[model samples]
Target chain A: MSPHLLTLAEAAALIAARKLSPVELLEDCLARIAAVQPRLDAFIRMNVAEAEEAAREAEAEITRHGPRSPLHGIPVGLKDIIDLKGHPTTCHSKQRLDHMAEADAAVVARLRAAGAVFPGKLATHEFAIGGPAFDLPFPPARNPWNRAHHPGGSSSGSGAAVAARMVPAALGTDTGGSVRHPASHCGIVGLKPTYELVPRAGVFPLAFSLDHVGPLTRTVRDAALMLNVMADGGQDYTRGLTDGLRGLRIGYVRHFHEKDQPASAEMAAALDEAARLLAAEGAIVMDVTLPSLDEFSAVNRTILAAESSVVHEEWLKTRPQDYAAVTRRRLLPGLFLPAVDYMHAARRRTQLLARVNEVFADVDLLLTASSMDEAALIDDEPEVERTYPRQARTPFNVTGQPAITLMSGLSSKGLPLSLQLAAPAHAEALLLRAAHGYERAAPWKDYAPPC
Target chain B: MTDEEIAALVKAAGLEDTAARYPADVRAALAQLARHKGQLPRSSDPTLEPTPAYVAPRP
Candidate 1:
């Protein structure tokens, strides 16, 4: 297989055995990015000079002493919201295109220490809120499966790049499913680790309390490998990955899609098939219910708006014209929201966490819909608006649980169909084990987009 | 909410000079929040405190 086609783990194993060169892998990825970038528009900036330097250093160091980690010579893209020292963290907005990151974000620092190469900064929604917007400084990333469709955001470019094989993995921050949305839409593995499991210090703040940083990769084990390095103490995220789900109790929340939000016919069918596949692996799949998706959406949105508006208040008052129309509408409400409402949202968040905990007590993981439908036309404003919030992701963000979205199957159109698996806080090991098992059993295992 | 109410809130935030639809958007937002308010179970007991949002890392 081509170096660009290798998963992180595959590439790492080859590099360790001296069969692959770090420089060779980085060059292959760079070449793929060159070929598909114009069509996909997945990157906002390319850190070529720094990345080439890092790759060469990794190559020489590995030759001398051996690899530092699985990512020792791997090229990983950083979402533009993340601070990478000496690079401008544009957040894909015209407003702060000149804002250079003085220091690496905590996660970036950790990744750098692990010998990962910085491929560049990927596109994000404007300040991680406004999206696929023509009015922004850069054109939004298009879906790899079907270029005309949305790639999902606010982590748009991260998902697009990984799915298109431009990079093995990329980092994305999720406030309300930004990571998982693109993961679902792009047919990749996206994990939002338990809130605060990974550091968020230097990433641009969308909603501080709700914010999370995670990886989008081609495989579940790849997600775990990235997490193992991103978090401190070197916790082994891959330890349980190959352990088949013989007796794992997975609660399939059908109501989230079937009743609360009503996912598309194809998505609904794909979800059922995914549950059946899990059961076929000797797992017990039981129907479970939680607070309505609407309740979670409302609570999550209210808090996100209130907090994000505060982050951008000065900009709104001074340079509101710089923001896209969708971004403005999304941020405007928070400006005048009664302070008491934010408090209520926070209070309800506590109760919601408890509710999910109660469910987790009986089941090892919870399965639900990530997006009600796959990528709609990127240019269809009304359709985008309609499908944007028809998701089960915000509930977990509100509950601060670890959730992973992986491709369940392919739609008739060949676009990726997705399902979400979530666990109680800090149960990412369980999430990966189940997701990895299903990925191996499912028909779409390691399926590449026809970009 | 009435236009007047929306206007007062906008003017209070000093965003009255923004687009004409700004006030209307605020009204719709407030209405949405009102709908969400109905979902939150009211706690009469002062002891049901909200989380500080972050807790120390677990061992």
Candidate 2:
């Protein structure tokens, strides 16, 4: 495999063993970017000189002082919404075309301290909401599996870049499934950790209550490795990664996709197969129920719209034309929402959180379909609009729990299908354990996007 | 909400141009938000407190 195609764990181990050089790894990534970028449109900008310089410095420092951490010298991309000191965090929006970061966002500071190299800022939906939009300053990222398809958003580029092997891992923020949505569609591992586990101090806010910072990587273990750096105080998220699913209880929320939203036959079958695989692996898998998907969607959308409106209120009033039509339309409703409705949604959210928390008493983790269908064509507006809201990923976001999306199988058209696993708040270790176990037992992780 | 109501809301929010430019989108968004409100239960446990706007890190 090319150096750029190596998982973060594989590359980190080689770099630590002195068998690989950070500079070489970075150069390989740069070369991959050059080859795939025109087709994938994954990055908003490239920080080549700085990344190369940083890689050289890391190589020398490691030669003298050994590696600082697993992320040492790993080349990672930042979603353009994240600040990187002097770089423009354009957020793939023309509204903020010239906006530059005065300081690194909290997560960026942590990644820098971990010795990760920044290849560039990856594309995001306009302010992480209005895209796969063509009218944005930057072209929307296309799926690496098939350039004609949408890679999912608002973490579009983060997923595409990682899946294409242009970067082993990237930072993505999830508000109502942005991270997991892209990860599912692009066939990668995306984790939206327990809310607030990673600080959101520096990234542009979508919904203050729903926003989460996470990693999109090629492997479950790599996602865990990235979390270790991204998590506050640098937790060793990879510690219990190898714990198999024997005796582990998994709650399969089949109705969320099967009946509530009624996913495509392909997605439903893939989910069932994933459940059977886990059951075969000695996991005590059983059907579990949560509130209807519509209930969760309502609560999530209400909170998201209200909070996002607050964040963009000033701009919406002064420069409404600056936002993409989708973003502007989505945000405009929040402005007109009665204060009572926002309060009611807040109260309902608390009730919903308690309801989900009750399910943890029965199972170690919950499994469901990440996206209802495979990647739709980038310009297929009707399909995009139809499928965009048909997801199980937002329920976990509403509950403020940790959740992960990983490949489960492929659709008939050769597109990736994904399964999601969510654990109670701060139970990322358990969540990852279940996902990692399934990833090993199943053949999904072995397939790579044909970029 | 009716189109007139949505138009009024847009005008009040200083987004008349936006409403004119993307009338269908603006109406759809408003209708969705209204639907979300309709989905809320008529009543809830008065004891249930709302989630805090900001949660401090646990020590």
Candidate 3:
């Protein structure tokens, strides 16, 4: 396999063994970006000169003193919403097109300290909400699996780049399923760790309370490795990778997608098969119920709209035209929401979180669908509008628990189908271990995008 | 809310351009927000607090 196609784990091992030079890996990535980026539109800007310089330095440093961390000398991309010192954190919006950061976001600083090389800033939705929009400053990222389809957003470029092998891994922010939505559609692994596990200091905020920063990568192990760096020395997220699911209790939330918001036939079947595989692996999988998907969605939207409106109130009031129509429409409701309503949502959020926590009393982890259907056509606004909110990922955001999305199967049309697993807050180690166990027993992680 | 009421709110928020461009979306989103607000519990335990569980780490 080409260096560009190597998983982060593979590359890291090779680099540690002195078999792969960081410079060689970077060149391969740049070549892939040059060859496929026009079709994928995955990056907002390429930091070639700096990346090349950093790669050479990494190669020299590794040769001199060995690896600094598992991520040492590995090239990774940053979603445009994340701040890299002296780079524009555009949030994929014209409104902040000229905005540059004087310092790295907390996650970027950690990744840099871990010796990861940065190739560029990846594309995102306009402020991570109003896209796959043509009206934005940059064209939306197209799915690597099928270029005509939407690579889910607003972490559009992060998903596309990792899935297409333009980069092995990238950082993506999730407020309401932004990371996992792309992971589901693009057939990659995306994890939204427990809220506040990864600091959001320099990343542009979507919803202050719900925002999470996470990794989009090809393998669950890679997600765990990236989390180790992003979480800045929390318990090693990869600690229990080989721990089988035998005797593990998994709560299967079948009705959330099957009834509250029914998934496509293919998605429903894929989730069922995934559940069966876990049970066959000796996991005690059983049906568990929480609040309805509608209730969670309503609460998520209320909180998101209210918080994001505060972030963009100045821009919305002064330069509303600079935003895409979708973003404008999505954000305007917050301005109209009464303060008491925002407070009510906050209060209800507390109760809803307690309800979800009640489920963990019986199970170690929760399983559900990520996106309810396949990726829609890039231009199909009606389908995008209908399908975008039909996800199980946002409920965890409301509960502030750790959640992960990984490929579970492929649609009949060849698009990816995904399953989500969530755990109690601060239980990311257990959550990732169970996901790793599933990835080992199931065959979904082995398939890659046609790109 | 009626069209005029929604329109007046839109104008008041300085989103006349957004109102003109996506009048229905604006209206629907507002209505949805109102519906969600209505679902909030009217009475709650006095001990319940709205603060999130996260505590910021020391710098």
What is the C-alpha DockQ of each candidate? 0.44, 0.48, 0.40
The window of 10 residues in a row where model 1 chain A has the poorest summed lDDT is A336-345
lDDT, residue A394, model 1: 94
Write candidate 2's Cα lDDT for A105-125 as tens digits: 999999999899998999999
Q: Compared to the true structure, candidate 3 yields what TM-score?
A: 0.96
What are the per-residue Cα lDDT tens digits for candidate 1 across A1-451? Answer: 8999999999999999999999999999999999999999999899888899999999999999999999999999999999999999988887898799899999999999999999899999998999879998899999999999999999999999999999999999999999999999999999999888899999999999899999999999899999999975668999978999889999999999999989999999999999999999999999998988877887788789889987988887777788887787788778877787787778877777778778988999998999999788999999998999899999888888889999987888888889999987787888999999999998686588888
Task: Give a tens-digit lDDT track for model 3, residues A130-206.
Answer: 98798988889999999999999989999999999999999999999999999999999999988888999999999
Regarding DockQ, does 1 or 3 come out ahead?
Answer: 1
Candidate 2: segments with Cα more than 4 A from true spot? B1-4, B20-25, B52-59
The parts of candidate 1 lying over 4 Å away from their true place are B19-46, B56-59
CAPRI-style grade of the A/B interface in model 3: acceptable
State which candidate, 2 or 3, has the greater DockQ.
Answer: 2
What's the candidate order when arranged by decreasing lDDT? 3, 1, 2
lDDT of 2 at A58: 98
Among incorrect, acceptable, medium and high, the docking class of model 1 is acceptable
Residue A66 of model 2 has an lDDT of: 89
Model 1 clash pairs are: none
Query: Candidate 2: deviation at residue A73, Å?
Result: 0.9
For model 2, which pairs clash?
Answer: none
